[model samples]
Target: MPYPDEAVGFMADGPESFGTFTKRAYKLKPFEEFDIDVKVEACGICGSDVHTVSGGWGEQLFPLCCGHEIVGTAVRVGPKVTTIKEGQRVGIGAQAYSCGECKQCRNGNENYCPVNSINTYGSKWPDTGIVSQGGYGSHVRAHEHWVFPIPEALETTNVAPMLCAGLTAFSRWYATVPGRGRRLALGAETWAISRSRAKEADAKKLGADGYIATAEEGWEKPHLTSFDLIVNCANSSKGFDLPRYLSMMDVHGRWISVGLPEEEGQVIKAQNLISNGVLIGATHIGNRQEMLAMLKLAAEKGLRSYVEEIQIGEEGLKQAMQRMKKGDVRYRFILTGYDKHFARDLKI
Candidate 1:
């Protein structure tokens, strides 16, 4: 299959001008036999994108095209590819490549493949200078192992963010077995904890059983030893109170962190986890099997993510990035209008 030599995207040259995207074309990496090229449709904006582009995480590959939550149609399939075909709808998550021979990959933990794991963006191919550009482009090329076939029942825009955000949410938890039931029981009560009460209404509206505002003093008193798990999605670790947050966890409860703020992470000392025997952990994006299971579950359950859509362009991207930094977006932002921004096939 014939593929384009270059792809156009809104590129960021440095952290100083991270939000200011300029339209430019970059050369595509050398395609291999197991690669698949996707025609861009909709891409999700993630906190990680903001952190990377702004140099919060660290120094990044300059002139980077940062977006990982990608959903599109397969336009070109290499001869070695078998599962995906041209015109099939697909999605690519944060990870694009992992050494399949590693222990993690062989055991269905490809996301943890420490050897030669390449991100969908801001990661360079080994022994080559070509950096991996992401979904914020006219097209993106990825290995077949990392490309997932989207379920027909799921909507493109709704499921786009799930590729990254949803996957992270999925693989971050470890539930304990109920002492009574032979089968896992349904209905685990979920509560939303925000820094303030501003989101209480919204959280309750979204089916949260209760809401806790940290701004209110003695907030964790009523809920002492109430939670079994806490998923920390905070964007920054600045001024994070570790002991207070852990106070709500029951014995043997876990705290899993999936957010990546550029700020230095809060240091966890032995005293912090000794009282409740809390387990603190973190994870990257989910593996290929988890991605497929997540999509299937979403389709069957008719799950919809709260998303705000913005057309792809310099101004739109700039506005989105600005709002993202301020926590202005409701939940997620999906970049649309690919056909209008890039002409058919992006013949540049």
Candidate 2:
């Protein structure tokens, strides 16, 4: 297949407002055996994109294309790649690559690999010395290992958010399971709090037996001590009446914290875990195997993402970023309709 000469999208200079994704062109790297070139059909805008663009998560590479939750068709695949083929519907998550020889990779925990881990965009690839780019473009070149074939039943718009938001929730959910017959409670706030409910719905679709939402009024009254695991996805540092919540858990219940509060130096009381034998832990994103497992689950359960669509072009991307900053999207915003020239493909 013939590759395009250029791809365009929103480009960020530094921690600025949402008006910064200006029109620009990027050169596609020469093809490699492990690489796959995609004609982007849809790309989900995640909070991480906003954070990276605004410098909330620290320094970022300039002229960055920030979208990570990507969905599209494989237009070109490297000769060495066998898992994916040309013209296949596919998606890429936040992580782009990881050193495969590490203990984490060997154990199917590539997300926690001790060596180098490459993010989908705004990070550097140790092998090629190229600053990794993102999915907010007319086309993207990715390693075949990082890209997965999308299931036939799922729509691009609905599956885009699953690349990041759904995967994050799913990784946490899978880690929290204790045994075959165990109940779990998910505590979340802000957008993630709502995502937790969606996660539970997906879990239920996958045959999850129990999930209780703590966001509703009087939510704690009924679910306290009802769960064997409590997954914290909320950012509140005041602590959600931990003692009360822990009291409801069965003995040896586990408490996992995935949300980081805005303020630094926040501490947890030891008594909360010590008194009840509740295990407290946190996790990063999943590795390649876990990502495949997640996609398989989504395929099997017919999971869908509640995403808002934004056209992929100079003006639409700027507006989409503005709306995302204001928390206007339901779950996620996907940039779509990228033609040969990203700026010209504005129909969406």
Candidate 3:
């Protein structure tokens, strides 16, 4: 097999099923003067990757390597790049471009760039005509705007998932005011009730107020129609009883779906939602400013994701993907040792 000196990644031929990862080379051409080159050190596996590779997120560009939660060391500095330098540690999230002149850009929400919002993977770069590949590769090419300098105190492995998964969860929670009124986060005990007591205790350490072990306690029967908002983060689409969840919502309550499952996974009955007069909505990845704020808060509070580290290799990546599909990872999976895996293959 030939090598892609410019960008080496474990990729798939097309969107189909999970565990189709194969190491291949992505030919890199000269990027714009504002673009910077990064040697990837670590990356987090996002649910978006699962969705895209499994044909759940609609058709995708084939031969794609999707991993946006990237942490790396900068080895090439474009002449026009003023902030990032060679040998600096940085990160890039799900976004690759947001034309700065748009209405959304003038606001602090550039991630919503209405004109041209380029994703980190599976999209063509406006500046260089390069279809943006993701971070599961030997190196990444990013524009100056989307690249972020990571904090010294944070480990690359810990901060990688914050790029997407943590960011999504954080963005929703940050804007909320749990203190303004009575509030409690509800999760069915089936999800939280780990086999061991240690798992239950770990939940308390994370500051969950209470546990609703649905199988034994039957929260729905006792607290029927008792909630205002629910942020459903479960990724599986099957067995989601939309009416059962709706029954728990008070009149005019809201349900937001952030966790994406396979296509046609969650069948929604229009009548189920009509009874409560409730609204359903969801959010995408946060903006650059939000990413910076997320890192700052993470640094200040010493917050880090509970991630299992796996050495980067074809077999290792395949196992990680499989584990994620089965819901085995505690929180996130970050792949490291990119330099060792592709030492001879990296062109620059």
157-222 per-residue lDDT for model 3 (tens digits): 999998888777666434443541134333322223222344566566665544444345445665
Stretches of candidate 2 off by over 4 Å are 1-6, 28-30, 172-181, 184-219, 235-249, 258-262, 340-348
Clashes counted in candidate 1 amount to: 1
lDDT of 3: 0.75
Worst 10 residues of 2 by lDDT: 184-193
lDDT by candidate, in order shown: 0.85, 0.70, 0.75
lDDT of 2 by residue, 42-133 (tens): 89988778777767667777878878889988988899999898999999888877777888788777777669787888777775666777
Model 1: per-residue Cα lDDT at residue 138: 84
Ten consecutive residues with minimal summed lDDT in candidate 1? 175-184
Off by over 4 Å in 1: 1-3, 172-186
Per-model C-alpha RMSD: 2.6, 5.0, 4.2
Q: Candidate 3 at residue 183, lDDT?
A: 45
- The TM-score between candidate 2 and the true structure equals 0.81
